[model samples]
Target: MATTTASIRVPAPPERVWQLIGGFDTLPDWLPYIPTSELGEGGRVRSLTNEEGGLIVERLEVFDDKGRTYSYSILQAPFPVTGYLSTIAVHEEADAGSSRVEWSGTFTPDGTGEAEAVALFHGIYADGLEALRRTLAAGSAQGS
Candidate 1:
């Protein structure tokens, strides 16, 4: 299995960061690439539509509201991987006013080399975290 992890520090409290991303179906709320998400299976599953109209289906594996974290597995996607499992967590930074958000995934390469697959997911996670940072910054600017 190949794994990739990306993290970013947001200038917001952990609770505030979790409020935006802790939900299993909240990808669209912060991920500009994912424009829409529909919850099914009583909110255990999410169907996401990307900006290019590509579809991705994911199932929530675990959720810990108190811990500000969640784990999910991709049920269907266009990526070249299988047995994908990912976790996203928000942790309190030493600076009480800031938080660290981490996104990580593990998967087995399907139609691609292990290095290529790792690069792909790592890029995705890094880009996603950057997007989260921008979203938080925009929100903060508006609130200020």
Candidate 2:
């Protein structure tokens, strides 16, 4: 199993980052590899249509806003993987002008490029976090 942890500080508020993370389907809007995700009651079923249109289906087992963590497993794909979990933490500083975002995940590569997978995870997530900063900076929205 391989693990990756990455973090970024956004000038926006934690609520804003939480909003973006809460909407699983919107990942495709900012993240490149995840073309889309289907959100559910307790978990989500996601389909990642790669750049060349390859499909990767995963079951997002844990989507906990209260706990700030989500787990997933590759149900079907071109690789072998299981028991994947990704957690995102958004916290506001006491000064009330900045926020911090942390992302971590555990993955067991199914004969795929572990390093690439970890890199992709951080890159896409960082981009997504930056997009959230832009979105919140533009204006406020209903809380997630």
Candidate 3:
């Protein structure tokens, strides 16, 4: 299993940031791979994504929102892998003007058992998070 974590400090408050990150259904607007999501427990999530020469199907696993953390698993997707779990956490800053957002995912290759392929998967994880950074930055600016 491989794991990666990416975080960003959004100038927007946690509540507003959650309106973006914590809201699963609107991911496609900011995140490239995620085209759309269905909110709520046991809801269906769909996305328009492509990986390499193949198409990507989006499947989302939603957790009960009780605290400052949310988590889910990718039960179905267009990847050659399984055991996909994604999580997001929101932390309020002491200054009260910003929030710390963190997200991460873990998965295993569906067919290949090679370390190199897994490494490539990890690389994508990093890239995807970086893309989120840009998305959040834009959102923050627009909100301001």
TM-score of each: 0.98, 0.68, 0.68
In the range 1-144, model 1's lDDT, one tens digit per residue, is 999999999999999999999988888889999999999999999999998899999999999999999999999999999999999999999988999999999999998999999999999899999999999999999999
User: What local lDDT does model 1 show for residue 140?
Assistant: 95
Model 1 spans with C-alpha error above 4 angstroms: none
User: Largest lDDT belongs to which candidate?
Assistant: 1
For residue 55, give model 1's deviation from the true position in Å. Answer: 0.8
* Candidates sorted by lDDT, best first: 1, 2, 3
Question: 60 in model 1: Cα distance from truth in Å?
Answer: 0.1
Q: Per-residue lDDT for 1-144 in model 2, tens only?
A: 788877777776666566766655566655555665665445467767776777877776667776555556667766444566777677677768677877777878766688877776677567666765666655544333
Look at candidate 3 and give me any clashing residue pairs: 80-110, 81-110
Cα deviation at 11, candidate 1, in Å, is 0.7
What value of lDDT does candidate 2 attain over all alpha carbons? 0.67
